[model samples]
Target chain A: MQPEIQPAPSPASLAREDDVLEAAVRWRAEGKAVALATVLETWGSAPRPVGSHLVIDDTGNFLGSVSGGCVEGAVVTEAMDVIDSGKPRTLEFGVADEAAWRVGLSCGGAIRVYVERID
Target chain B: MDLALLTALNTERAARRAAVVVTHLASGVQRLVRGEDITSDPLAGDIEAAVRAGRSGVAGEGEARVFLNVHVPPARMVVVGAVHISQALAPMARATGYDVTIVDPRTAFATAERFPDTPVIAEWPDKALPGLALDPFTAMVALTHDPKIDEPALEAALKAGCFYVGALGSRRTHAKRMERLAALGLPQAQLARIHAPIGLDIGAANPPEIAVAILGQVIGALRKPAPAREAAA
Candidate 1:
């Protein structure tokens, strides 16, 4: 049976930063080029939803995700390119992918991800 | 900023039920430069005083993107109908953690004499809804299918930005309602937001099943997908 789960205790505070927001803050603090990737849209059994967030540091340290492990590796590579070029970009991931099997993800949904270099 | 100041700002905000945030201005400048505190919970008092004291929001990070999300728990469901469906829906909605309210202008029907512990509003939606702090987190359903009662509440709900707005009716009835809403100057986009057909395509038949489907869709809309990685499930 697919176990029903509710969200965790939320790490529950803005003061006590979670890993993702913390990373976004830290990367910018350290003056390393970074980009924030937010999942703005999804369709057909997507692993995530609009406003789902990811923080990608210039060195490719990732903080959040838009899909079920089926897309971040590729997204990180793309993030690095964004960092180098200093341009915001969008990318999509799906099962029409050669990388799905390697990531061990359910390969059926497509998620649209937006990467913006937070200024 | 100092952690004490941050904690003070946030704790007050949480007590007042507001959204708080922290922002990094100019992308590279860490620590909240302006218009940010350590909480997504909004704050009160001299915002001007605070901003002058070097509390500026991130200059580059435009708009209010939800920063450290704190799931504020389930929204309340204020239903206005003692009809059969309301019976099935009220408890289920409550169980899913909605603070349920049932209203009916009919005293005999809306009597709290039966739904003990549930606040039975024996007034119309227009009367009762003025008190229901309808916000983006609220989920409202008008089960009466009566034009007089359901219409008022539905209008109040739609204008308030309720997260899930629903009305119980068939395609033909909803078509007319849509026209009425448009006449009232409700925009087409706002009307589109209401889940008129209500519930998933689960072939729901009777009241209880329909209630289940309605709540299910509500949950689905509220849900956020799990992170990209879950550490081997």
Candidate 2:
């Protein structure tokens, strides 16, 4: 006989990763303007691997991390502009850029983040 | 990053299916590729490689450059015997990022006190495994050494195309199993997939060491190139 099957349980880490995108969908459904920032590339000792997501809302609320607590403030600030303009922006963070000096990766790594509004 | 596309991505994730989000950095234009459609995608070559490696990165060059964000369901390990080896393997599998579950009809062996922090189902494999919805992402290990218990679980795992299928037995025991399975109508090709005398040949002499060997074998089956795995099978 064919038995009723249930979906397998997801690992905690995978669930955490999905939580980022799930929150973006949830926030957007709640009428909150949302922006998603994804780590497109990373070099050297990157804290988070590529594909890590950081979701932000118009009110400056956010979930997830694109870096090790560094550069998130800047990414959130940039995400607000993305929400307003509806234009995607790519931000690069590293010790090499002067802007990054203000919000640098303390791990001496470099990363490129793509921030886009969920319209 | 359209809400529709984001929603679609999450839907695929919740269903435990693989998908990729291809985003053009210059134009901010994006598209979602479900696992089944990857072969027909324009960037099929790159997307296939990225999905296989379970990685995300920038592809192409210049204005045509795009980011491929790969999402694959986490691997799962389902042990059919809640015995001594499971006591060691469950925690190790969790640490290595696999969702783990143990099933055995013998309630005494599958007790919560013996497997703290691990999910133990005190039901026969035939009853419990069907509800688990064994899939390609799952690794199945049958360790009870009792044909009545282990055989059915192995059969189910094989039929489900589990990424890894293993059974603990000596060569003689495995040979007898092959005959029994063949008589039950499983094809030779499918039967060849079972890793009898399970685990990597690491000279393990105890339950914990045997668990290490099995976990290593499962990881290798999951990560190694597809062609190589087929050859080994």
lDDT leader? 2
> Which docking class does model 2 fall in?
medium
DockQ, prediction 2: 0.56
* Model 1 clash number: 15
Tens-place lDDT per residue, model 2, B206-233, is: 9999999999999889887779877765
Model 2 local distance difference test score: 0.91
- Which numbered prediction scores highest in TM-score against the true structure? 2
lDDT per residue for candidate 1 within B141-207, as digits (tens), equals: 8888887888878888889988678888898998998898888899987887677776766899898
**What DockQ do the predictions score, one after another?**
0.02, 0.56
Q: Score every model by TM-score.
A: 0.49, 0.91
Chain B of candidate 1 achieves a TM-score of 0.70
Clash totals, every prediction: 15, 0
